[model samples]
Target chain A: MPVTSSRPVCILGLGLIGGSLLRRLAGERPAFGYNRSTATVNAAVADGYDASSDLPQTLTRAAETDAVIVLATPVTVLGPIVDAVVEHAPDCLLTDVVSVKEQVARIVAHHHPDARYVGGHPMAGTAHSGWAATDPSLFENAMWMVTTHDDTEADDWLAVADIARAAGSYVVPAAEDAHDRAAAAISHNPHVTAAVTAAVGAGESRLPLRLAAGSFRDGTRVAGTAPELQRAMLEANSVALLNTLSETIDRLVAARDRLRDHGDVAALIEAGHRARTAYEEVAAGEVEPIVGVTIGDDGWAQELRRQAHLARVWVG
Target chain B: MPVTSSRPVCILGLGLIGGSLLRRLAGERPAFGYNRSTATVNAAVADGYDASSDLPQTLTRAAETDAVIVLATPVTVLGPIVDAVVEHAPDCLLTDVVSVKEQVARIVAHHHPDARYVGGHPMAGTAHSGWAATDPSLFENAMWMVTTHDDTEADDWLAVADIARAAGSYVVPAAEDAHDRAAAAISHNPHVTAAVTAAVGAGESRLPLRLAAGSFRDGTRVAGTAPELQRAMLEANSVALLNTLSETIDRLVAARDRLRDHGDVAALIEAGHRARTAYEEVAAGEVEPIVGVTIGDDGWAQELRRQAHLARVWVG
Candidate 1:
């Protein structure tokens, strides 16, 4: 059975993720959203979405119904939203669509200690952002990380996982810090790497730029992401990002030295090919599934995390 | 006017590039190709194109007609092929589709110094290789590097440039050394970086593997290229590859250090975003074209190289 509650979902900040979620879940549940921009709110309302520019009023409505609240704002502007949540909807089950988990979890724990919170990050996005780019099917088949904390409640975890499923994603349960580290490896560090590659390709001459083809274009694609938005997530996960970035630099530098000294890049290219093959196998769904763990058993969070570490998902 | 050469083109090694070129240029100008594999030759001949496995006979035929001999084999195999060209077609205007121009230029200079030669590198490929993977339109609108050495003949250069245009590409006039350096900056170094990124993403745990998305996917797409082919090109351009790799490493290390020391990746991210914007503008064809230069004048090669340095194309 799907672990779900009938409580309404209140989405804070109707940007891409929030607006999409509201669109997907609006008719199914008593879902509503808040955006700071009146123009966006009016547009959403005109499109028959229950959206408003009033933050406190939206939070109060969510609190009155004991709703599940999703924070879909950028990490930079999250503090004030959390503050508003604390003042008006302290009893709500909290979750987020933030890129980094530990920072948001820390903020929740610091600002509203008694709030029932489970951090979430749906691994989906396009190069575009804002409400205009929002799509209802943004999270289809995407991995939504529902994080586990020492103080995480079973019911709260189930609530957020239900939201993730409703948004059309598989749930990958992880601890807050582990989520950040894995994200650094997969997302944050890749951003920095892409940025560096793009900057280097755009060097002192136009020749490299003219000669660049598929590899350069694809490798440096994410470097086109908004600088401030990238900085926010990258800086928020600095510790893990720093470690991952250093590891990447080490690998690149070693490859360089090998090429300089031995005139061969076979080892690095071979290893990378093997890794890419591994990814292809998983992506093709050729790998057998790991055994599943029940939600809310003794040591269930740890067991779920272990299974997730093994690349298993709980599509609850 | 389109530079036209009625000379037949003989391609040695019917791999992806050669096979595609043969398919494209077969009827336009008398074109035939030779592959070591009998199956590939049979397949091409069955498709109603002139292809053969007999290298000596092919070169001898080309010798009688004074055809342009395009050395389309890998760099490692070029020495013997150049020797064959010297033996059978010493007076033929020679060229190659090699990835690195300087190495092929050096080989031609050593083996057939009196042979009129220009090196060409077409910036096009799929991950797949071999005759089956060949597509007739691979070079459509692609940039094809036509290299100039101190002894490069105007008519010889025009012959290769004509072939590139006939195969549907924009001609980029560059000196052999400059082509290798530009290629290292755009292609070879990007391959190494992708390999490192893929290897790093596939660390000890499967979490990163499962979490890999579009950025990681595109960033490491070239890591999936056949290892031997990548090694051939990367190793051949070791000097330029080493320099570009070191520059990338330095930039990544600085980004890492900044993230560690001051919690700021703004400079790097900002610079990268600006560079990506520049690429976008150029890719969108918003950049103005440089003034065209005449093909055979005093310092014409130097003038064409200068225009190419400003991201101009000769499309002749």
Candidate 2:
């Protein structure tokens, strides 16, 4: 069943994604956004957003109106955000935008069973982070993976899809393990490879490296990525990441051995060529889009607009 | 000592680099330029270049002038070019613009000891090849590695540097072995890796790769490289290239192991970050410029111009 009430949407942890969501909603409806960082909240307000730094106050405001509360905190903070949301807004449908689905699902299941929680991970980011990098188009053409288990309510899944659509993503339903494995293969493994390549090259004389041309720059450019976040993700999904990393290493080592022993380097080169082509194919969306869903008329949009208006009262 | 008369500058194989050299010398002096392909000479003439398809005609032109003959053909064609130059313009300083140095040096030693051949490799190119990509700035700010053996004279080395300087590169002297090893580590190995990475990514079914963000595109963009030329370089310098490939694989495997074993991924991430920084340092020339000597005097420039003019006319 679709959400019948015009509940204002309350977004918790207004960082890059949350702030961007608030900005997008502000354009179409009144939305309440809260961040632990006072400066972040202030910056959002300065940008004319309905945001607050106080979690309890924000949650109270969300409960008074028919609003869905989205937890946009890091994985470490997700549990606390859930507890706070449940305590303050028991009547609200709760969801999260964390990358890991299993952890969020378990937390929601154990603590917020009656609070209508759904788990979502939007596959989008920029080199830049924080509220400054938040843009509505960030989610455009991005995949929003929403994972549900056997205990997940049918209505809650639909509501999660609705939110993802509103955020401008193609909502794809996947199990937790599948999502984690796929992400490990594509995102995490590549990032690690980039880092390793950079490290090895850097170990060379710093002077010669300075003269590195376009190819070196492009191959190792991602090495400058945020280490903490990458570490966290790697640690969180170590099992799947380990498998993908091992597979990549095996391929590279085999190629190296072939070249060393004067064995056929053609097959090795061909494998790399094939891998790059496959990656390009997926990136170009030449394959089917991951998420498939059709909008149910404009009813959800109208309700979202009504909720946005009520949420505006808490903005000031 | 400088040549008593202007050295004749003969260019063997009037393709991109050869034709460009001929064209640049058009109004100033005529230089002998030969091409195996009759169509190339015709195209050069159409483009106002003084060139010929006949080796004897080009050789006769070189004999009349104090010229240096540059072999700008592929590695496989360099031996024949050296033979032609040696048989015709025995006194002319013979040089080449091939990427590999050791093979060129060996051929020169065996077949053209009296021809004063200096091995040259300009570290500059575009995705596009042929006469169309031949700009005078092709060697600007680029490294031109000049390899000389015990048999090569100081005068011949200086002349090779002069030609490279005129072509807009900073000339750096290296032994044939050093040049080959450096080229394999920086250029040839990277191409193979890029091709393999692209092939792998392209083989994926996740059509999300089709949306291959900027990083993927940038990383695998070189996969479309000319396979024939790449294969030749790999085969020619297989020993050094294999060594570098082994090193790269070792680093990649180490990183994978770290991630798999739940060891510190931080070290791996840091390595990548450092590599990128080192690359930037080299590209910015903050590190010492690798190749050519700085021609700080207008006298040297004028002398080069005068010699280039005489060589061009003799060849024409």
Candidate 3:
């Protein structure tokens, strides 16, 4: 059954992700958004989004509606945002889109136990930020990873998946620690590597770097990401991130040692070749597709045919 | 004085670089391009270039012309190609467009002591290969790093620079060692890193990768590079490349350690910020442009004045 409601959906924190969600939801539902900055709220309003800078008014409005409140703030701000949402929207289904999950899970467990809350981290973003940089397609084809703790309700987890599906993201279920470790390996560590490479090259000849064309520019592009947020993510998921970093360092060291001792350049090149081949295999779909796949089996096909035949007989 | 030339230019190995050079030179001077493949020679001829599959005819024609012979083969093939070019174009100034300088320099010294061979590596390439990928603008805005050994004549070195400039590359002078190190740091090692990152990610899950939107795809896109050439480069510059890779890994490890120890994620992020800031500073011409800067200070000021004058000139 469709849980149809005319009440507005309230989004807390009108940053890039929040703004984007509001922009998409406004087409279907009565959407309202609140940000700390009045200027940002005014800009959003001017851009045809129903938004306000008044947090109290926003929370009050959220409490009255059968709306789901989404906290789209940084890891540090998540706890406080959840507290505020709990005080205001006592009956609302609370959710957060913070990258780190353990801390958020703990916070919800301690404070907002009465309110249903699900922790989500959508694996998507650009190097840019703010409401101006928000795009509706940002979440499209993205993995919305949800982490469930012992305190998380089954109903709330399902609701979180529904929200992710509605936002055009494939729901990926993972434990808090597992998600953090995986994220560190792929995303967090890579960002740090890019930054360090840029730093080392920058220390060398600044002149040659300026002349750096496509490859260098693209490689270090993510180094331009927001400092404070990156720091928070690193701090929040420190242990896992450090482990991945160590592994990466060891790989490089091994390559270096082989070059110094063996003089076998071919072996070094083969490593790179193997890596590239593996990556291509994944990208080309020679391996399993990451997103969900719907397969209609022989039994399903037979059932469909039988149903079609029955329908045809009834029509005749 | 322009060396009065009755002799045609001989281009050995008519691949993309060689074929492009042949096509360009055919329009301006009498040129002969030799390819091992009869089909390649026929195709070049059909494309209106003066090319031959017959080695003796090509060598005899090369000997007859006061031609400069250019070797445009891979590093492994450079040794034999140099021997052939030395045997044929003894009096002609010889050059090459090989990526590595040290190996080519060593080969030229050992086999072609009598030939005027200046080592050149054009920092320009497309992902594609073959004669069909040849473009006139291939060398445009490219840095043509030239290396001269002790035996190289000043006039021969000057001739190579003149060719590079005419082909639209700004020639930069460097030692073979320096060029190799720089190429390893910027080009070779980075390719390996991209390849490894891609491979690791691919090994984990192809589905998540396919669902990988912009940033992940863009970051690892270079991993799709030709495995054979990528490996060859790694092998050739293994020592220098390993050093670069080690340095990069150390920085990444340090950043990760700081995060792990809960030392200060903010500081690490700040380091990243500083690194990116430096990169931008270098990129924006606050530092010297990598491809040798064309405009002098006086010329730049005059150009600015000229642009202002043009605005006034047009208005008036």
Candidate 4:
């Protein structure tokens, strides 16, 4: 129940993730939020939630209550939001729910170097956005990645992890750089690939689209996400995404060459089949969690990251 | 409802498509099928369905009844099945529900050049296959493509289309080459691309696998389909798929280069977004169906192909 603290949680922004976070935290702790749009604020308030349009007032109240300030805006808009946090609630334990961790960490460091900040990214969302699309159960059983570094404060990490767990997520501890790379491999690159695949169908005229069925729809599903949102995440983590995208392109080239030259894609199909089997094993709970890693003990970061590399979850 | 007579329908190979087709045709017509595996044959017979392991006797019965023989096995096994059909049911009206149209068209021409043949490719299936995964409702509201060639007889074409309509699907008429090319763009190439994408995540450490969420899962869902089945479809359509696969790789390379050199993916993302939106329009019933095309009229093949090219359906 998040340590039962009276130090309220303050959320800035009320789009899908932020709005959903505000609703999810309603009974767990004293939480209030601010959105840039007054209509969304009014909508939340009319629904009996503590939402406001005044960012300064929101941060001031949060500061006075010794709150945990959560920055919940797009990566492109994080600069001004971080400046607001620096001005009014610079001393609060800070966290964020952005998609890219390293970029958010850099924004926080640039805005207020001395601010007690912990980076967070909940690996959850849908194609929809805005407060109207928000649902309190959005994070239920999702993975919320809490980033760690050599100098990160253990207490601040625990505070954010507690909230993430309270919101019905399994907290995954990762380093900022590692999280961005992993996100690029699993999320951001696939978004670009999906977009490319979808554009191919569209470019082929409507005949291909009419013949399109499950594979085309499934492979290109993420391409339907709002474009600007996709840009924010993909551009924010462009470095890691480039490497992964190139590797993926190389694999395709090899498969193409094999098909053109030898008329065989046996190696490619076999590799993919085996990989999907491994994922099924892990998803079906065949991989056991690694126990005995105390959250605050010395060398815990190394141990936890090791557990993640092996696809094992942390029990604590 | 289908030009009712004592004529029966003979299905070869009671796998997913054939088994499901046999089930779907139960009350509509007199149907019987042959499967190579006695186990599946026994299972169907025990369930009171007309299934047999004797290919010679099955084809003999089909020949005597002036049946329509549906070749439902994978493309790799189509040679032997077509040979059996030629040996016993050479005069029967023939069709197939294979994934690729032109390949089966070539096989039929090779095995029985004078046979009454109309190629079919049903654009509906789950990732799962085989007898156990058979569903009677599999083809309900699905698109079943009926192929046309220069020498195709109108009665033969209508005969196959009627059976496909009876199986509960919209009948789309396309030329043999056009159907294979369209399938390559939408289905066959996507299978190869999915294999590459899934292998990328698997090639990475288990961390990426653990972090794989919606986009990764959706993009790679078909990669989990039976590898042998994937090979059958992909290999049979290799010529057309190579062209489509090459174009897809070019798009990815361009996106990757843009991301690497200019740190910009706006062009790529917008193209994909626009394409997906276009697809949504068609799937959402926004595109009006083309009317006034009389089936089997003069120039009807050209007209229907044009309608399909414009992403319009033929109502009658």
Candidate 5:
């Protein structure tokens, strides 16, 4: 069953993530927002979001009434935010929208013994940030990855899911450590690699960069990702990031070595082609109604009849 | 002045590049195509491109009449083809459309004293290859990098430019070594890095790949590069590739270290953000109509009048 509560969700920090959530769920579900910057809070209020800059007042109101409160601040500020929430809003189910999970989970666990906490990360963002860039449909078709600490009750899980679902996101279950490792492989290392590639083009002449239109531009596009947010992710998941980058460097070295020795790079390219093809196949399969079949007027008809016994078949 | 030769060109190997060129130029410029496989040659003929399987006969026709001959084959087969062309079509202005420059230039130089050779590479291709996938507008707005060896007459330069122009490509002047180095840094290394990144994702489960839709997908999209062509490029420029790859590893290591030791990744990310912004700005500038200026009522108009004095200015 879905979490049903009359209490509004209290969103801390009205940046991109928080503002997007507020925009997505303001009318359907009541949301109160708090941000460190008073200007941003005022802007959010002006834009029709219920917002306040006073932390204690907001936390007091949330603790007294809200079903869940979302902390959408950077990782560095999370410890103090969690502590403050624990002291002031101990009754509400607390969750966070940080990129790194294990450290965030540890923070919640350390500030535990009162209110429960669930890890919630909606995997949707752009290179642009701030409240003005917020879109109500930002989370549509996005994966809202979640992890649960010991104190996370079933009701608490449902409450987080309700928030994500209200924003049109599908909740994906994840173990904290596994999530970090996967994210390092998929996100952090790719960002660093893209940055390195982009830096190669950032030289004296603008000709190469000008000529870098198609594959090079698309391939290294993520090098423009928001600096602070990326910094938070990479530093927070340092161990995993290091491991992923190391493995990738090793793979690149091997390809380079093979090219050096045999004067052949087909093996590496072929391997890449296989992986890319698999991803394409899977993505294509998601859209296809049916793949690879032959229908005849024989035993296949009997099998079809058996499968479709509940419905009448019409001859076309 | 443009090379105004009316000589019909010979295109060896009716694959992706050759077929695309033929399709683009056949209506205006005459082209005679040759391929090793009879099926491909027949397919080319069926598609309205003049082609045949007999190498000597086609080469003889091109040598007797045409001003330019384009060897559109794989790198491994380039050596024998150039040798054959030297023995058979010695007077024609020889050229080949290959990804690698230095090695192909070396091959042309070694088979010398007979036919002139100009290195031509139109940086336009897809993962798909062969005659069926050929598009007439394949090289439109693409950079056709070229290098000329000895015996490259005024007629030879224009002949090559004629073919490139016919395919709607602009000729980019490049020295063989500089071209190789720049291509290694921009094209070859990026391909290998993307391949490695894509391979990192090709594991047991499809979950990570499923979640890899945004930056991960965009960053590694070039992993689908044609295996043989990309392999030719990476292997041919292995020395440059290795140097580029090593430097990238160093940058990535530094980023990883920053994240690990100081818990700071902002510097690296900020550098990346700056580079990305510059590229975006340059790309945006390509389309914009003279940005960043203020036209004051009095002094600015007088300054503009003064600047426009060297040339005639039409009033809007």
Candidate 6:
């Protein structure tokens, strides 16, 4: 609702996140869409989206209006998307909805120094993917991580923040490297952990495996995620994930040793009980939400530090 | 119905399982309920249960009526319950509803030679515990593991099986050692692994912990379980769990190495995908139900082995 011109918002890649972003921005702004699929683009155009017949035409219209370009493609296509956008729409403000942030931010910074690109990642998704599975309310009350490098422009940051807020998310400002590390620990590392736990527990025998009912099912639900997608995310952030996973395994082995050597797993159980309690408290809205995160203001960053302390939102 | 007298079914502990068993037996047969909680005993009596004033009186009346005694208590209480039941109702066919089957089965076999005891473990329960949480439909279509040692009598086994069937469960025949091993892999091992995972994932840094939403929460729901209860279960089956956890860690490390060195995690993802498919197949009722598990026949055991292959219900 903040003051802005009538420049259109163009979203590339009609995938789940892109489609969702387009649908959620309905009526808020003039939406232009592009994708690898012609049928999908036609479907969007039929639904009243401003559709260009091709990427060149779309980029031409967007570059004319100094539009906001949202890159919603996969990780592998990120570099190419940035290069294309810089070549065709140098005046446009750019951002991304990628899972991994540091590499994307660095690549953007190197590829087009004149273009202002804010790295954005919405901390929400389901096991499903593709345009058909897009949910307009997917970002409702979700944490939308907006990352900034040393050369990030304040105006560009605010523009992306406006879109994220409009999409019904709380803006969480983090450094580029911090976002990658955090994603590894929370999303990528635990993902592999769940898969590995289920696999080893599955074992070669079937008798005990059948007994893997409620608890194992709940513990390893993420293990059923599409393999190809999981592989990309895990390997993309392998450095941080490998570190977190090694430490996690060490901690688990220690717990195992406690049980085997001393016949006591009280310490392990107690620690889990404490951590779960803390997490539940936050989930239940027992902590205040972070709102209107300031980009470059010293006092604003200080306020962010205080909020992270109170809300338990640390810089990973 | 089977040409039996008016002998009652006596449930010794009146915990969740015992209470549920008594409630389910209502109108099908006369029920005699006993528990340490005199208040719970009175509540059951008020609700039309044939409640006993005390343990000795309960046992004496049960023995006089030729009752089938079900010892439903905590793991620590199993041995004592068996001793007391044998002392009072020596002629009755007895069984138990303990979580860990092998230890309880072995203890019952060693303590009282005259009493025919069939080891029982119902693979179902909520986060709630005790008499208040009892549900008559708790075991409806649930897997009820009935364990047998060499000394177990066929008549006694069938008596327990009849009760299990009446309570609406698929009676699965397994050796005492087999039941323990299966429970360790499926139930006990996965349980501790969840707790340990949650513990490690919930380290002091709040950044990543806050980002751990659905996947982490789903993976670690068992971590929020009561500390003392988890402690007892994890400690009780430490040997099997330690072995399983070690293997799981090794597999995870292999996946980590794959991600770090070769930039591949398909092996980890594939293993998880395969295991999850196996589990989901059974869960969706794709696998045939365990029917007519043979007791002692050599060909019967062979039939069970064949059914394991056909039904895809292998030993874990």
Encode model 2's per-residue lDDT on A251-316: one tens digit a residue.
767776776777446765655655665554445533243222223333433332222222110000
Q: Label model 1 with its docking quality class.
A: medium
Best by DockQ: 4
Badly placed stretches (over 4 Å) of model 6 are A1-8, A38-53, A148-152, A291-298, A312-316, B1-8, B20-28, B38-53, B148-152, B290-298, B305-316
For model 5, what is the error of residue B234's alpha carbon versus the real structure, in angstroms, after optimal superposition?
0.9
Off by over 4 Å in 3: A1-8, A147-159, A162-166, A265-316, B1-10, B14-32, B35-56, B126-128, B131-137, B148-158, B165-168, B207-215, B263-272, B281-316
- The better-scoring model by TM-score among 2 and 3 is 3
- Name the 10 consecutive residues with the lowest summed lDDT in model 5 chain B: B307-316
Chain B superposition TM-score per model: 0.95, 0.84, 0.80, 0.95, 0.84, 0.86
Candidate RMSDs in Å, in order, are 2.3, 8.5, 8.0, 2.0, 9.9, 3.9
Best by lDDT: 1
DockQ of 3: 0.30
Give me the displacement of residue A76 in model 5, in angstroms. Answer: 1.9
How far is B213's C-alpha from truth in model 5 (Å)? 3.1
Worst 10 residues of 5 chain A by lDDT: A307-316
Interface RMSD of each: 1.2, 8.2, 7.8, 1.3, 6.7, 2.2
Cα deviation at A9, candidate 5, in Å, is 3.3
DockQ value for model 1: 0.74
Per residue, candidate 4 scores C-alpha lDDT tens digits across B1-316 of 2445335789998998999999999767899999999999998888779999999999999998889999998888899999988899899999999988878888999999888898888888889988888988998877788886656777777778778878887777788888888888888877877787788776457877777788888888899999989988898899988888888888888888888889889988999999888877777764446577766688777877777778775545
lDDT scores for all predictions?
Answer: 0.85, 0.64, 0.64, 0.84, 0.71, 0.73
Candidate achieving higher lDDT, 1 or 4:
1
Tell me the lDDT of model 3 at B276: 72
Q: Candidate 5 on B1-316: residue-level lDDT in tens?
A: 2455355778988788888988887867677888999999888888777889998888888878854888899888887888788777887888888878888877877775555777788877766788888888888867676563333454565567567767787555455665676677667777877777777765435545544556777777888767777776677777877788777777767776776678677766787788788778765653222122233223433332232222111111
| Tens digit of per-residue lDDT, candidate 6, span A33-144 | 7897888878777877665548877887889877789888877777777777877898888888888887777678778877777888888887777777778899887777
Candidate 1 error regions (>4 Å) = A1-7, A46-48, A149-151, A286-292, B1-6, B46-48, B149-151, B286-290
Docking class of 3: acceptable
lDDT of 3 by residue, B180-217 (tens): 77677666666656655544443243333433434445
Off by over 4 Å in 5: A1-7, A42-52, A148-152, A287-316, B1-9, B42-48, B64-67, B148-152, B202-204, B266-271, B287-316
DockQ value of candidate 2: 0.27
What tens digits encode model 6's per-residue C-alpha lDDT throughout B76-142?
6666777777788888888888777766666777777666777787777665666678889998877
lDDT minimum window of 10 residues, candidate 1 chain B? B286-295
Candidate 1 chain A, which ten residues in sequence have the lowest lDDT sum?
Answer: A286-295
